[model samples]
Target: MNAPRTLRAALVYFNDFENCQRFMIDLRWPDGVVRCPTCGSDKVTYLADDKRWKCYAKHPRAKFSLKVGTVLEDSPIGLEKWLPAM
Candidate 1:
């Protein structure tokens, strides 16, 4: 989905977890392929329960969330709140 045009719209649009996730995914991986940020590998799977991605290839940091490798990394803030502020 397109980004909200106004500040109020963004606040409403990004309130939902699913909408925030999809917005971040699209913003991060515009091509629709999620990859391992550390290894640059595309062989990854999303763990719905965990709300993160796991790289199948053996690696030290196989599991990653949307915040990994980003300014949001290590922050406790949720995307539902962060995305709208961007």
Candidate 2:
């Protein structure tokens, strides 16, 4: 077995923006299905370029990020700093 990684090392792991986004996506939707939190619509598309999810439903706000509806929604801090604290 290998020795456990230190806190500093683990933090470095999350420092990568892409990894942080993937981690948050998994944490939020374990089944890997991205849905619209607003209309509860499963018909959503992954906007990779913008790093946000867009709901196909006819709504004023069709686009949203993983941060939507969560406590960290308005926080400037990313999942890189938030997940470690969990």
Candidate 3:
């Protein structure tokens, strides 16, 4: 998102749940192509209900979230706080 006109506006934007989720989603899939981090497969399906992406490849660890493979992995804190604090 473009820089807000004020710091308060930035805070308001980051506090929004949907906006934060969108930001994380975009950050995870910067190229607009969602791939499985485990198996390196592009045929992944977004399971919004589960808040994670599932790979089409047959594997036990076929699901991953934005936190996976990053420093934020397994973080219980939501992105609304974690991302902004980063």
How would you order the candidates by TM-score, starting with the best? 1, 2, 3
Tens-place lDDT per residue, model 3, 6-69, is 5667568879866776776677777768678898899998898998889999998899886788
- Candidate 2, run of 10 with poorest lDDT: 1-10
lDDT string for model 2 (1-86, tens) is 22116777658777887777777778778887878989989999988898888999999779999889889898998877886665
Per-residue accuracy of model 1 over 1-48 as CA lDDT, tens digit each: 688999899999888888988887897899978889989899999999
Q: Which stretches of candidate 2 lie over 4 Å from their true place?
A: 1-6
lDDT of each: 0.88, 0.79, 0.76
**TM-scores for every candidate against the unseen true structure:** 0.92, 0.78, 0.75
Return the clash pairs for model 3, or none.
Answer: none
Clashing residue pairs in candidate 1 are none
lDDT of 2: 0.79
Question: Which has the higher lDDT value, candidate number 1 or candidate number 2?
Answer: 1
Q: Which structure among the candidates has the greatest lDDT? A: 1
